[model samples]
Target: MNPAAQEPLDPRDRPARLTVGVVGAGRVGPALAAALRLAGHRPVAVSGVSDASVRRAATLLPDVPVVTPAEVLARAELVLLTVPDDALAALVQGLAETGAVRPGQLLLHTSGRYGTKVLDPALRAGALPLALHPAMTFTGTSVDVQRLAGCSFGVTAPEELRLAAEALVIEMGGEAEWIAEESRPLYHAALALGANHLVTLVAQSMELLRAAGVEAPDRMLGPLLGAALDNALRSGDAALTGPVARGDAGTVAAHVEVLREHAPAAVAGYLAMARTTADRALAHGMLKPEMAEDLLDVLADGDSLGDTRGGAGGGAR
Candidate 1:
């Protein structure tokens, strides 16, 4: 067993502060750097290409100089790579090829989809790789720092560096949830399905509501959506409700027709979600097969609804 793996790092009492540097001033990097600064780590440098990023770095990391990526690595003991998922590998390769990675530096990336494998090049250059992806959304603002207080971070690192990774997340006021290297992709997909797709579904629902003459769509849906989310979180599949769960085939069929007429683009999404909801309801015994027969037929015919748009009959009214 590696001795360092068992050592606990004090979040606020570490006298030996590692100078932190951000390689991309995207929302995540600056916010994380700001949080670390709160825990007594010095933010030395950061790099960002866009004007917005420069402004963001200045806001979150006041007095911390914005420098080139190579300069950031040269100046700091801990480097945060907060680039997009697609750009991460290439950026790491570029840094390594340029001989910029400092030996023994804590090289951490904030990408959820990748684990330590993507940091292998940096690791070969004598860097200690860490993957610490915060499982919370970033709004590219200071509020993101506050949101980290009770947030969970998806952590992945070599066994020897697990303590180091957890310490970093803890220092940022986050819980460390260790994800296996092979399971990182699946973990990220689950998050995206829950968080990212939720935004799309809400936006579509709001748009359809507006088209149906509902004013203040957000206001109208806020309480209902909030309760639904809370219920699902608390009860899981037992939280299933609405026309689909009740096997109200007529109501489901009417919803399909309204979406087809009022918002043609939302028809497919509505159908897909309804079908998924029905499947889950059935699996959980919330929906009976005999009752679902007509509901299934309605969903199965969703593809043809796009072409045969009739007058809107039923909606949020």
Candidate 2:
């Protein structure tokens, strides 16, 4: 035998190009399959239920056969179960029950909420299980594949299969951050709380700016928000600023009244968030105790806005 042929392959090395399949060609599935294709894997088949998913598959994975879920497992050496988080369990159980999962085949899911435990049925059927969740958001566009470069993947797998998981993430241009199986839920929740809520907060700020007569809210917010985000990432609680952080109770009270008049629906959220901010600032010694009392009272009482209504002008009516 030749010397190279006689050597055993390293477990952490990328596996030879495998035939890939996608069970749900939603925004994430086709994008990941496309990335894998870029890594020299062959996307042999994909299954998509909705018209949108079918179209997306055609866009991101042109020429790959669109087949049934069972057919996808039948033909692929590496199957990506990219269905909605809610439907993943049922789909896996169904696949396992139908004997569709094959021995030694690789089965991966893109769910952040779950680790490999959800793949136990497939595991019992001799399928290799991997939970590789990209921490970045996907737009169902070709850009998502490019975005995967330097992305962080929350990875969980069997001890024996750890290297294989890392290899796949590396192939997709992602750095693997191993998450303990038991910590998956908390890990996912933190992502949702930060990323999802940040979108809501930014949109709300833009709407409020528009109400304040800013002609181009996006332009005004771009640099401010960018710097704020960078500062928060670098300094954590020490980076906090604005009226709440300064313990400016009068300024906050004025804001509450303005919001109550202009955006009554947003008043409750504003109060809740300000209280939380106040708590953090005080705990970190950014807010003096004496300064906190009035701020807490302003945040605690909805009627506190009434005190600031006199200077609110005739437009308040």
Candidate 3:
């Protein structure tokens, strides 16, 4: 028996601060590397291909050298692979095949859709794998460092590496939430549905208001949307309001008709959301089953009503 192997590691003995390398200096990579630097880790090198990325690296990691991906991997103890999700596997495999990734190096990726499985190639090359995805969006600016504070990081790592993963997240001023490896896709989908789709929804709403001749759509929407978002986040289903939540099928029908006539591109989205809202209201006991049926009927009749060329009648009144 190796006596040293049986000895317990002391919690007080913290691991040495790592020399970090960024493989992609896109919006997420440089921002995260900057946060790591603030956390006392050193960002030694970065790889950026685009002109914008090179400019961003200069802004966020001014002292760090811009180098090739292989050089970045070869020089750092902690490697951050922040490329697009589709590009990650190939990059890791290429690094491994080239013998650039070293044994015992910690390799982390900022991909929301992927967990440590995508790092299998690096693992095979004896690198430790961690998946750490920040929940907020980034603009590839220094401001993202402040945004990262108090944000949740969806982390996936082997049980033995959990502490290391969590500690790194903490150092970057983030809260680490362990996500099961199999749940990565679902987790990422939820974030996309909430954040990405919300942006599209808001843009469509602003356009609709502009079509209606509102001079300052943002001024009109700012407070209402902000309150609605805050309520929805704080109260969930209980926060739901508006015609669909109130089970006013006629109001929804009228809205669909107007959108079809004026903003045909938005009608489909409106109908889909109204139907979903009605279903949710019903499930939450906020709407009676009969009222839900009525709402669903209106949503189903949207296309036929669009052909009528008449304003929605008394039901809307």
Candidate 4:
């Protein structure tokens, strides 16, 4: 870290001086606070559910006070509620229940699944509600802490809160895009279906590889996955490939059969994704209309198709 970079001396560092408090000091809270501090802003207070989290905060944010969520709001002008998704609403409600939030304070959450709606109570209390979700994974590692610089942050808030949230996201060296407040749940659902479900899909692939006696699935798959991801990123819909993209009905039938026999649990996800994927392949002009129809017919025919290893298609979605 550059010494100059450590100082929030620039005029643009206004967001840093905006007294910030963090709740749920798990993976995201500490990382966010560290980013704020590195940007030369004050991370005034933090809170967590467990001793371990508090201890972690003590190490990473040594100068900041360890306080209850209420104390955090009491002292800080900007409060980031980085708790688990299920717990976020409860935390906001809990704070509102106690009337702990101060007027004119800014309340934000890191949940991709929710927008300002989670902080309805705070909004009702004359605080502004914002949602700033980093569109990347956080493994709670030091590397992830460093790598947040270039990630895109999905930001949503009422018009009054939007500029501050965008400024905060920009201060973290990330790009910020405004999402509709009402559309946030649907938007977040799409992200979950893409990112979270991709995790499951990759894990399932690893499981299949392990069952096949492949050694070190991570080592084996990482490079292949990386290249496929690169192609997908560059070409967008044009990157679609493999059996379904080629309109190979026989291969699609085989895949369904194999899943039914060996990975029955995965059949539903496989079929659903395949049908959607086939539609994309058709749209991308990768498959002829007849072939796409044939593939969709095979995929949609509920009873007959069995699971088999189908063609390897590179997908960008």
Summarize candidate 4's per-residue lDDT along 1-317 as a digit string, tens digits: 22432232323233447767899888887888788777777888999778878877887788888888888887777788999999888889889889888666778899988877778888787777789998888765456567778888889877755667777887777889788877888888888887898899899999988987998998899998888889888998787778878888999988887778887877777877787787787767787887776677667663344433332333322
Flag regions of model 3 displaced more than 4 Å. 1-15, 304-317
- Per-candidate clashes come to 0, 0, 0, 11
TM-score winner: 1
Instruction: For candidate 3, give the lDDT of residue 315.
Output: 26
Per-residue lDDT tens digits of candidate 3, residues 120-231?
Answer: 9888988889999999999888899999989999999998889899999998999999999999999999999999999999999999899889999999999999999999
Position 1, candidate 3: lDDT? 22
Candidate 2 C-alpha lDDT tens digits along 1-317: 12442233343443588779999999999999999999999999999988999999999999999999999988887899999899999999999999999777889999999999999999998888999999998899999999999999999999988988898899999999999999999999999988998888889999999988999999999999999999999999999999999999999989888888988877766776787788789889998888888887777665455443223221101
C-alpha TM-scores of all predictions: 0.91, 0.90, 0.90, 0.83
- Cα error of candidate 1 at position 22, Å: 0.3
What is the C-alpha local distance difference test score of each model? 0.87, 0.87, 0.86, 0.78
The regions of model 4 sitting more than 4 angstroms off are: 1-16, 300-317
Model 3: which residue pairs collide? none
Q: lDDT score of model 1?
A: 0.87
List CA RMSD, all candidates: 6.0, 6.6, 5.9, 6.4
What lDDT is obtained when candidate 4 is compared to the true structure? 0.78
